[model samples]
Target chain A: MFALILPAVLVVAALLVGPMVLLARISLNQYSATQLMIEATTAQNYLNAVADPYYRGVMLTTLVMAFICTALTLALGFPAAYRLARMESRWKSLVTVLTLIPLLVGNVVRAAGWLGLLGNDGLINATLRGLGLTSEPLRLVYTPGAVAVGTIAVVLPYMILTLSSVIESIPRAVEEAAANLGASAFTVFRRVVWPLALPGTVAGCVLVFILCMNTYATAVLLGGSQFKMMAPAVYDQFSKGMNWPFGAALAFILLAATLVLTVLGTALLGRRYAR
Target chain B: MGQVRAGPGPDTVTREAVTRMRAAPLSPLAAPALAGPGLSVRLGRLAFLAAVFLAYAIVFAPIVMVVVTSFFDQEIVTFPPDGLTIRWYLNAWAQRDFARGFLTSLQIALAATAIGVPLGTAAALALVRATIPGRGFINTVLLAPLAVPAIVAGSALYMFYLRAEDWLDMDIKATLGGLVAANVLITIPWTVRLVTASLAGLDRAAEEAAANLGARPLTVFTRITLPMLRPGIVAAALFSFVASFENLELNLLLVGPGRTTLPVAMLSYLEFRMDPTLAAVATAQILMVTILMLVTDRFVKLSRIV
Candidate 1:
């Protein structure tokens, strides 16, 4: 067994655990523009991150946007997931393939797609003009809305896929029994289906939320420079600012926030389920 | 049946049609209330299905637009183009950076898949079949890469590489070798998950029977286990290759000069330009992934990929 697992352990230790430790070490070191990082250890980066209003604002925006995106994804994805779950037709596999195609497309490509549609002179605006909806094209790109829309598109497949399987696990007979008992469709859905699907809902939301929190390309491409989110900020610090220590500090903070929120959300959802 | 009577052959046919139609409404199994109890409910259902169709359209529109616009005869990516042509494809082909980047990405993806598959499969075997304590924790640790943001992983590995180079006096950072390592790290979880699932569902009685027949463990594994794992291995390798190929954040951070991958190259171009050439490149990527996925679907149900 040890022999079987040894290669995996080595790879994990060398790649993930080792790099994380090195990242933490770098986070504690002094930032140097020329040498990448100073040998001396300090908490200056963390201190600055905590003290700065800009970082705090960015953090808040990241949290708020992530929450909003999670809610949106859940709302938009649920119905489709229901369709996929209840479907018995041969079209199930076709729909499933359609759902996963976006995931297969890289983030850059997805962002590029959004650019095509969301740009001022893009398809939507051109259509609206052709239909005479407005005199001039409206600005949609590089806004918070664009970011949310793009991120939702990015994460919706995960939500749908998760909830479909979860809902599918529920026996159809249970629903049939409720219907046979003269329960309204709404009541059966509300009382029988909703409660049973809570765990999947929680899992899917948490996953999507964390993914939204860590999004970089979407924020950079869709949100643009005017909007600053956590992941892009971290990337900026490390790559553009040449501040590895500060970047690492910011990354750890995001990690902590993500973990804390996930746990808190899960606990809250668990309690709600019990109720 | 109660009021109408047949007079002749034509009247008899009309009576039969009426009887069949009347029987449909009487049969509860044939006509559920949800299908059309009231105009409001029917309209609501129609609206719901329309919304679902609209959602799917929204999801596919962007990807479809990229492919459609690639054939635009104009220079820019405008809708309702002047005409259809393959000029952008030719332009994309002529772009040397994209060609080189495509080759580089292919090389890296192939290398990463080659290294990650065996290690991941071995680990998965232990994870699925081996009797060990704390296997849950091992599973979590092994799959933790999925949760870690690629940007963070990239930054961490970039720092680690720099530090390691300082200590070992070897230049490995920003090289193809370094890329392979990072890509392998990110991709192993997927391989392990798919194979572990396949291995879990497998019947291991054949291997046990072989052992009972006095076959050596290695022979049993080679002849029995490996053959059983073929489908999973193929799927895992495909996934690993795609994951590595589609990766951008890590490549953006670790890619050296003249070593840009296709995604990285696309990102840089996107930062500067907005033309149908990008549409061409995206179409190429979509086509490649679609073909690969279709091939994999022949071997396994595509729905199980999630």
Candidate 2:
């Protein structure tokens, strides 16, 4: 049994763990423009990342945006998930396929789709002009709003899938029983469904929140070049600035932030619902 | 049916019973009106259905926009007055970068899937069948990559490759093999997840029976366990291929000149031009993935695994 698992263990250790350890080491090194990177032990990279106002603002923006997207996704996805979970119509399978189609399409492609819709001459503007509702394009594309919308669209399916699977297991009989006992529909949801689906909600929110924080292509394409996020900032440091140490530090910061927030959120939710 | 005779039965009646009562052929008037939902409930249901419809519309709007833009005859995509044409697709095909990138992506996805699936299957089998300690810990470790941000993984791998190049005095970064290795890392987690789920559903009695009948362990695995795991293995391969093909952030840092994958090529193209040619490219990709998923679902029921 151990032998059967050795090949995978070796690959993961050598590729994943080895790289991560090397990255941590590199993050402590010093970056010099002439020599690229110098071997040294220093806290300068992390200190610079933390102290710089620009980087601090970018981290904050990423956090807020991630929170907003997660909230919006939950708001929009829960009803759809409940509908799908309890669907008895013949169209259930067709609806499921439709829900899944966007997920299979990559984020880059989806962002491109948003580009065509929200651009100056794109669908939304064209429709607005045709309707005589506005004189100008309204600056829909290349805005923060566009980034949020695109990110929500990309992650919504994931939330729906996660929540629906959990909701499906909750058994319709329970909800019906609550209703039979004269509990209002909202009451049934508050007292029954909400607590039952808390675990899935947490899982979905964490997953979507992580994706939003690390969003690269959507932020780059839809938010335009001026808009900065943690992932793209990390990319720019390595690709354009050629600052490996700083880039490694930024990557670690993003990873740590995501991990800490996810753990904290899960713990808080778990504790609150434990009663 | 016997409970239908109880007084004020609306509280006890199941939804299916009401539906059946409404659908009964012999007595249309016998269907109880009181069992149906009240007017407010009906209105609320209508509102919920509309909300669901709107949600689906938002989810699909961008993808539909891309496909629509791809058919526009104009060079620049302007909505609501363009004639239809397939010229953008032809133009996309003529672009050497997209062509080369598509082939490169296909090869990488294939290589990654081919290698990652078997290794993941073995690990999953060991974890499921063997009474190993710390099984939960090992499972978490295997799935950890899925949780890590792709950009972080890509940067880490890029830096690690550079260090390895220095130590081995050999070029590893910015090569086809290096790119494939990165892709394989991402694919393994999906394979492990799907195959593990599959193994959990499988009955071990056949394997135990074969062992008791004096068949070698290898023979039992090959003839019994592997065959039962066929659907899972196939699903794993399909998903892994899609994952590798669609990957952008991981390949963004690892790709070199002339070794760019399709998503990277598409990104660079978007940076340069906002024409419908990219839309045509994306539409082609969307169609291919949809068809592949539909076909795979025909055999494996993707809803079960995904």
Candidate 3:
């Protein structure tokens, strides 16, 4: 096992962890991007990140947005997943294919597409206006809502695919057995299949939750500078903001948060299902 | 592959069609004998599926619109233009560095897949086939890369490349090799997971039998396991290749001067000007993605690969 995966392990370690420690070191150092040189170590950058209220807001908003998105995905996802799992006709395969098509499109294209869809003179607003639904173009573009919409669209596929596969695994005999013993479809579903598929649902929810938390593209494209998220803030601090130590601190903190979620999710979901 | 025994069970007509199946098999034909999802709850689910379909339509509308808007020569962003024209496609095609950018992206993506897929498969085989100590811990640690946001990944790559240049006193950032190095790291998990799943479900008997029969391990592997693993490796390589091609975030951070992938170039252009021509470029990208998704889906089932 070790030998087969040795090369992949090395590459990931060198690219992922090596740079993380390097960034940590750079973050601690009085790094100079201009001269491209670093002075000896200092704690100033870390202090700036923790002390600043602006950075605080960024972290808070990111966490809040991630959770909100996760909740929205679950709420919207459950019914669709249930329907897909119970699908009749030859359409089940088509539906499965349809759900996955979105994954093929890159984030850049997806974000750009949303810009057109939600812009002031975009089709959505135009349709709304034509229907006399509103007087003015409701600040649809460049809002937190737009960010949520884009994020949901991108992440929805993962949620649906994961949840549906789990749902499909529920044996019909168990449901029939429940119904045979004087249970309705709903009762049988609630009592049996729901519990059976809970692992997949939980896994999907956990994955979505973490991806949303780690997200940067949707935030950058939809929220812009004002509607901050944790990942993008970490990004700006390193790139445009030009504060290495603070950025590194934020990155470490974000990494820590994701790790916590993964552990909790595994304990809560994976170990129980044991699939 | 998962198999479903078509037709209803214990039927003279349906059973004649097939011996056995899995899941609720489709009736040989839609007949009065068949029942839909329960009538009481059936409407509810149908309505829900309809709503989901509408949502899917909304999600897909942008790509559809881009394809429509791409043909516009109006030069301005508008829905109902003067008339549909194909001039924008020509302009997009002839645009400076756009062709070069496309070639660069293709080259980088191909090179990255060449390195990444085999390494990932090797990793998967090692992790799954061997009784290595701490294999689970090592696999999780390796996949931890995906948990990091692309921005951080890009930043790390940029910084590393910069330092490498400093140490070697040679340019490394703008080169194809640098792009491959960054993308290979990003795409490894996909190939590893795909190959590992394939390996896990694989028939080990052929190789074992071959070894006993006096065929060398290498010969057995080439004849038996490699043929079986080909579907998975191809699918993984294709998926990783497409991803590498369209990767904007990492490229945005690490793509050095004088050479930019198509996506990074489009992003830079859009940062300054948003035009219908960009839509043309976007349409071309969508076309590539459509083909890629089909190819990958055919070779490897997404559910199993992950």
Q: Model 3 over residues A1-275: C-alpha lDDT tens digits?
A: 45567778888888878887787787677656685446668877777777889877877887788888888887677667766765656677667766776766776677777777777766678788888898788788788988888888878777877777676665444554465466655576566766676767777887788788877666777776578888777767766867566677777777777778767876866576565
* Every candidate's chain B TM-score: 0.86, 0.87, 0.83
Q: Which stretches of candidate 3 lie over 4 Å from their true place?
A: A1-4, A31-43, A87-94, A131-135, A180-186, A261-275, B1-43
Best by DockQ: 2
* Candidate 2 residue lDDT tens string, B127-245: 99899988888877777778779999899999888878889998787687888898888788889988888888899899999999999988998999999999888888888899899
Off by over 4 Å in 2: A89-94, B1-43
**TM-scores of chain A, one for each prediction:** 0.95, 0.97, 0.86
TM per prediction? 0.92, 0.93, 0.87
lDDT of 2 at A90: 57
Note the DockQ of each predicted structure: 0.35, 0.42, 0.35
lDDT of 1 by residue, B209-248 (tens): 9999999989999999999888888988887788889998
Model 1 chain B: ten consecutive residues of lowest lDDT = B1-10
Give the range where candidate 1 chain A is weakest over 10 consecutive residues by summed lDDT: A168-177
Candidate 2, clashing residue pairs?
A: none
Judging by TM-score, tell me the better candidate of 1 and 3.
1
Q: Write the per-residue lDDT of candidate 3 for residues B1-306, one digit (tens) a residue.
A: 111111222233443333244244332111111255457655654565576775566567667777776776577665446677877877888987677788899999999899989898888877877788897898787667666777777777777887889899988788888888888875797777667777878888888988899998789878887898999898888888887888777766677667889887776665545567788888888988777777777777654444
Q: How many backbone clashes does candidate 1 have?
A: 0
The candidate, 2 or 3, that scores higher on lDDT is 2
